[model samples]
Target: MDSFDEAVDSVREAIDRGDNVAVVSDPYGGRDAVADEAEEYTLGVERISFSSVAEADGYEMSFGGQVCVVEGCRYLYTRRVDGFAPVKSFLQTVVESDATFVTTWNSYAWSYAAQATEVDDIFDDVRVPSLSSAEIAELLSSDYDISEFLTDYEEVTADESPSLRERLPFERLRFGIEEASDNVFEKISGMSRGNPGVARAVFESRSWQTDDEPLDLSYDDAFALYVVVSKERVSRDVLRRVVSPDSLETSLRKLSDSGVVGFDGDEVVLRPQQFADAVSYLERRRLVW
Candidate 1:
């Protein structure tokens, strides 16, 4: 079976054995898809979605001996040292209650929480797998009538010119292509690291290539980017507490100018279209594992 079906079966088996389940994935990974699919197998289970940490405060899970699916469990806390109180309390309630809880979390947040708290002991994790090249192609084909994927030649150097057939990246043109291969999808999948959302964004345009020069971030800026990505969407106040206060503002300004991140009122978030590029940049610098 495919990854989605395997994830659903894992959840079903865990529930059958009376174990709490934790659905984990990277930011913009397919956590929601797996959780939603699994929820369908859970007849009569109540699903509660927490949009923010404040929404989870004092929320008791009293479902009268039924299963409960908690979506957006990643939003239950920030990455700050002091910000875990809300999620800790929420997890405590889950452990003490009679309801079988199936929760979803961002993989990075889950990794940190598992290290710092008893989260690893409380839930059995079912991690969402990265999409294969074929899977990425299928996902893109569903939305766009992609008859052919031409190879991009903009980056080719004069000294090392490639034949039209050997160029791999998808060209912007949609029609009148003479050849087709899996190379284009493989390139996209590799660049996106097989994250579907990132793959889709990369397919639309080469987002990593900005008019501005390539990113040259300092350690503080890189760390700040890591924190923002890990939390998905973090409030500026909470972000300040976690990153170096002296350079936080400057770091954010640089990232914003590079179009790597954006602001939503008081919250800072990684730009969805730039997600793959940002993550790749971080991984290269050893800022993210």
Candidate 2:
């Protein structure tokens, strides 16, 4: 079975044993998908989603339900020294409650929380594994006509023209050139490090012929990007709390201009399509683990 299916099965088994489950994955790595599939397999699961610590602070667990699925549990805390109060309170409630809970967490946030609060001891973890190359190909093919793109295994001279197949009229819209190579998906999977979301982003970048230049970031900017990636999506206020305020504005502006991050009103988010590139840049600088 695929990793997602395996995770769902794990969740089912955990629930059957009356155990709370923690579904952990990288940002956009299908934690929600696994949780949703697990929830659908059972009936009468109470679903709750938290976008911020403030929202989590006001939530009260319902003793009436036997199963509950909590999405976005990563939002319950920030990286600041004093930011874990909401998550601590929430975890205390979960420990005290009798209901079995399925909580989804960003892997980075889970790592920090595990170290700080020993949350790994409370919930049975079901980690979502990264997609394989074949899986990545299947996923992209479902949503796109990837046959039109140039393949990595194919070779062509600089003066080579389109083949006869490229001259035919097509009903579906096409991007980039025709003639797909067999190794294109492999290249994408490697570049994305098996992350489905990042693979898709890389595929789109390749298919659309958009080139991403290497990023040159100051230490301040790199640190900021690291925090943003770890948090998944953080508010401007929370970001300021974790990063140095002196260079916060400059770092944010540089990141925003480079298309590594985007703003949603008061919140800053690493753009889904740019995730792989941003992570690669950060990793090279040892800013992200």
Question: What would the TM-scores of all predictions be?
Answer: 0.80, 0.82
* Model 2: lDDT to the true structure: 0.74
Best model per lDDT:
2
- What are the RMSD figures for all models against the true structure? 7.5, 8.8
> For residues 1-289, what per-residue lDDT tens digits would candidate 2 score against the true structure?
2677888889999999989989998887888888888778788888888876557755665656788899988878776776777777778888888888899998877877788786788887889987655566678878787666435323321224543433335411111122132467655655565578777777776732455677899998988998788777778887788789989999999999988899999988887666766777776897655
Off by over 4 Å in 1: 57-62, 150-182, 206-214, 284-286
Candidate No. with top TM-score: 2
TM-score between model 2 and native: 0.82
Candidate 1 lDDT, 40-84, residue by residue in tens? 776878888876555665566567547788887866776566777
Model 2, position 64: C-alpha lDDT score: 63
* Sliding window of 10 residues with minimal summed lDDT for model 2: 171-180
Worst lDDT window (10 residues) for model 1? 172-181
